[model samples]
Target: MAVSVTLPALGESVTEGTVTRWLKAEGERVEADEPLLEVSTDKVDTEIPAPAAGVLASIKVAEDETVEVGAELAIIDDGSGAPAAESAPAQAEAPAEAPAAQPEPAAAPAQEAPAQEAPKQEAPAAPAGGAQGSGASTGSTGASGTDVLLPALGESVTEGTVTRWLKEVGEEVAEDEPLLEVSTDKVDTEIPAPTAGTLLEILVGEDETAEVGAKLAVIGQKGAAPAQAEAPAAPAPAQEAPKQEAPKQEAPKQEAPAPAPAPQAPTTPAPQAVTTPAPDPVPAAPAPAPAAAPVTPAPAAGEADAAYVTPLVRKLAQENGVNLATVKGTGVGGRIRKQDVIAAAEAAKQQQAAPAAAAAPAASGTKAPAIEASPLRGQTVKMPRMRKVIGDNMMKALHGQAQLTSVVEVDITKIMRMRNKAKDAFAQREGVKLSPMPFFVKAAVQALKAHPVVNARINEDEGTITYFDTENIGIAVDAEKGLMTPVIKGAGDLNIAGIARKTAELAGKVRTNKISPDDMSGATFTISNTGSRGALFDTVIVPPNQVGILGIGATVKRPVVVDHPELGETIAVRHMTYLALSYDHRLVDGADAARYLTTVKQILEAGEFETEIGL
Candidate 1:
């Protein structure tokens, strides 16, 4: 028996989840309670464990596909992977076995199997038997109803918003006919009826969401009174319908192999091929039944590329003002590659430069065309989903807090020299580039310990200020989707190298759009590296609850008045940076802000990382 793996209810509000990645591939042995795949909801990202110990026989859903609660994600073969194959010799022993199993439809409930078996059951008064069989087939076809489900739309798409109903309830529909339109985060597509029948019971309403395999509508006999009738044993029929459709699929799939192995392949792979198509239907829907949308020869890689462009790619395009739509893809089936995005950015720069060069007019200085600004010059475009969420949060944070900033400059020459010396060794050991951010994090952690007021949150309801003991620092990343802050949990406990490694890991996830919601939470303090973009300093907003946010500005080599103990007040070239602290003025006083910033500045300038850096 195969056990089903389904999307469990994560929370009352989390109705759906996206399958981000499968840790265990199909056919891989999975232990009970072991992580099988990573599921991402709007609120959090977590690993879904295997319900039972078994071989993951089949993966019904692919990575990045979304599914709702109770939606079957995969089939685990619990030591029952080869019952049919094992009993094959016995099945082959009895020529009458196929016919014997024909009436198993009585027990099976799929009367459609009788129609498939009828051709082999040609024993009786030919005309009389034919007439009876014909009548039975017609009656079954008419009465046997199908429950139309919200099929797997795309990878990582759990539920679909029903945009419109193409056919209303009580409407007659042909098999594979358009029924309703559904929109997901990545794609918008119209769904089709499973079979030719009367449209009854539109279970999922327009503009509402239904998970994969959730009832969308019901199709019954022609002219049958359309009622809100739930199809009998919907889950059973759902699993079997694909099996019935699998054989009816195109010949191209097996055409080449069938000819060469018509006789030699009676024992092994052929039977598995026939049997495997049952599970295979989930990925590649048969003939007019497309799992995502219209079944095309187009590669799913291309589909994935079109739908889920990584946040980094989107951000790169955004920063460079490159139109992703205009960029041509060089990947499979014209899938947009990261390189393609980069090329487009470069092309955009060249195009803008060409116009400026043309306008320069080769020293003759022909005046550029007086570009008149149109009334609709800046077209009003809807914000991206991530951007909207970010905007809302920023506004909410601003409205809720009385924020103010304090700045201080620090000499990080020692830290820069240390990185320059040990970067290669550190990268080799930690597999992450040694950067100044980790040193800043170390300084912040050390400072937060000394001045816990800046690392604390206010509870107005309780009228209490809670100062956190452990420093969980959130490093604000300008992600492709929006601004994301991936936290370095227990930053105070981790050494400089540990912080560096964790920083790289968290930052990689953000840049790749794989950073889960949990990874973005639990920050007692925050750091914004504005200097990476060459800014001297920025007034970074403190996150809600957290009292302060430290902005680390660019580390630049500049001439500074150095107050040397030995050579008093000498001018020296050093790597200097400005640190800005944005704090909640209501909770943290000006003195508290000054103390934390000054402490962090002192720690960095004091240069106590020799032991950690193996200097």
Candidate 2:
């Protein structure tokens, strides 16, 4: 029995994904949980893992194919002896149409003979071996019955505009053949076929925008008749050899005049006239050709309308001072399109028949050369989904709560010395590199215990500030997707080593995109370590649900005067850093905010807690 592998939902908003690549081929033995394919959604690129250990029996879709959540991507046969002959007809018919329409050349004749022969012997038993023999082949068949859906290209991308189709229906496409191009806010990418097959149908057209998970196209097994009456029209034009052959003689009559004038204008007109007659003679000589001439012109006119027109054409026409109205639309139904204008303009240029030059504007009429603006200038990018959510929450925090910022300078000489001395041993024993962040987190947690107001969130509507008894510090980590805060739960209870381990683990998960949504929520306070990158200080934004966020600056050695009760005042070299505490003013007063920061500084500078905290 084969286990069908369905596309997994990557995120809450990600209902579909484009198969970027197949890491392993069909029929290859794979281990459970092994990465089998790479998929790209708007939020991130993720690897889909094989569900169970088995031979990769069939891959239903090819790389670059977009598929919806729950769509079968591949099937795994768990070393079961082939299924009985009863299933052969169903399996044989599954992908018949898609494979036949693909653009790539069909699989070698020899490889397919056995499968074809076995299906004749008995339908049930043959399907199992057939399913395992060539997964790509079987997948092409399977795809015909399924709809390949469009994937969201990014978190900000709710839908994509189909830019162009690279393959026509009935083209034999390879597993990873580029089927179409799509454009989203973040990128323009070519979507590939999910499995090798004949393209059976195009559900969307160029320039049409479809929501994520919308069906784009259908693929069917090679040589399979289309399930619909309109199937013959879906395949590539070349596949209709007999149908197209008749039109070949007629096409030149239509294409000749469009291309001739452009090429001839630069040369002698006599040569243009000579070449024009040659194309006419060929079409006129063929009897079947003339029959198609009248019938074919209408569709050709329609196709000309659908062919792509770029902005460059419009710009060129404007620049060259060509009147698009006068130029004929050679494109599908006499629409004044870009290519038609360009071709017309180029032909005019070649003929040296420049239109009467417009009178040059008076020197005063130039009106101070107009400045062209940059494309990016004045453009507003819509905030990404994550950033939008973060922005909304931050505004709520600021508007609902009184926000205050406190700055403090801390002497870290003794702490730095201790860290330098124990860094190697700590890293080796704990399997986590020691960093100043853990010290800051620990100090902040201790300070919060002493001043719980700094750790409380305020509810303006309820007219209350809620203080948390336990210290849960949320550390901000910048990821490619956006900013994420993972909490170190019970930070006050853990020593520096424990803090380091937890921080490292969380950071790793953030990079791997495995951090659960819950991991990012429910924090009492947040920390931003801009200091690691040499930032001296920065006012951190208060997270929506949190009371405060601590910004740690770079540590530097500086001279300071020290006065002690037992010793005379003296100048001492101290490792110092600037700290900025941004707190919800509604929950924390300016004095309390300052005092909390001062206490955190004292804890770090004292150097006595180093021993107690087991740093």
Candidate 3:
């Protein structure tokens, strides 16, 4: 008996998965519960196990092909199986019986020439039947469907990765509605459907890369069933019926030509040529069907060029203002390596230099300064689009506004002492670890409440200054992909414990790549803790649409003069840190920034969270 192996449901929401790799090929024996193949879904990648101990008879799904849940993936045949065993022998016997049948005609050498020539003339008809059948089936779906192409994501972005698919095969989608999410090096956006129709097929799966304007999927009229599988299966049996009759017809034709073998000697080798190529074309005919999409061929040259430009090289080119298309690549297969981008930037710099400056370097016999390649330079990968977007936003903030940084030394001895005393109790009660960051955020929110100027934004288009009622503070988190700022909405309303929980939740999401766009927007002020990375202080750039960003620095024990109630001004060892505020001077003046920082400094020094933390 042949056991059908169907794709098991991997998740409740996951309707389909792509076959990434097959561990066991057809005809390979497998043990029960053994690993069979690797299936990749948008949520996870896992291996499907063999259902029973048997020979792997056939694989219905090919690698890179996606199939829905409960669809037959492959068949495992035990020794008792008849159909699988019968079909195997039939195909195997056809080629083997050809040689065996030749001996009968060879017994009389006189008739052998004509007999062999008959089969040669008839062999082509079988292949033609098979070829036509496969062609018709493959073209059926394409004829009525509209190809959903990968549209232009952004300027200079030649390709994008399909991060997810919103619609599956057999699902209906509306025009201009988001069907999938594409992530380029510069943007992460949704690609919408061109027309309202049923999604017939998906040429590209999640996490797969496709060039711009390439066919991503196919959409047909609503209520039209997918004939991709049925059409091909229906034609295979019809084509084979004619193929079986070809050999029988050739036998009779050969019987009529019972003549001398001398004249037919030249035609004897003709059968070998016909039989050899007959099998080759049948399999090769269907190979070009997938490539039939007209969008594929025209972008061949562009794919070759853009395919090699990895995200690392793209970012480097953008940072240096070097055009990637113009630079000649020297890496393997003309890949745009990091070194290539660096060299191009140097060349552009030299071109921009004065004539005297260029000549002086040549006269001095000194070579241009070369950047040392890091060990990580050789590795190429598609970086997340968020990184490029972050860089672009930083540049825009610097150029689009009058930005400046102001630094103030803060004595946080009381805050640190208060945290040390209340951390264990706070974690036990709130179920979140007590970190100095939450305290800083609490103080920053409080200061923003007092001095709303730092927490305000200027709308140049409207020519107005808008002061937000609530402090939607954006916490800058260093995620693996890039810098992410997940906002803590209504931070002014949240206490120390609430702030701690929200910060931890947002950071967790950032690290896990689960943070959504909704979590990143609507921020009136942003805070960046450079101190976590051991930095003393940094002039963090203000994000776009925001007027100010507060930079927290590392705290260290230092001797500082302080006034006490009993003792006069005296130098004592205390924990101190620096706070730098980067604000757009257009909306926030020097005095306003100073006042905000001063208020935060006073809050931290006061350590008024004793009751809030149950200290």
lDDT of 3 by residue, 254-359 (tens): 3333333322221112110112222231223212223222232232224444643555567688999998888887643345556778899989877766664756
TM-score for candidate 3: 0.44
lDDT of each: 0.63, 0.61, 0.67
* Highest TM-score scorer: 1
| Candidate 2 vs. true structure, TM-score | 0.45
lDDT of 2: 0.61
**For each candidate, what TM-score against the reference?**
0.52, 0.45, 0.44
RMSD per candidate (Å) reads 17.7, 18.7, 20.2
lDDT, residue 509, model 2: 73
Q: Each model's number of backbone clashes?
A: 10, 59, 1
Name the candidate, 1 or 2, with the larger TM-score value: 1
Give lDDT tens digits, candidate 1, residues 550-608: 99999889999989999999999999999999999998899988988889889999888
User: Per the 3 Å backbone cut-off, how many clashing residue pairs does candidate 1 have?
Assistant: 10
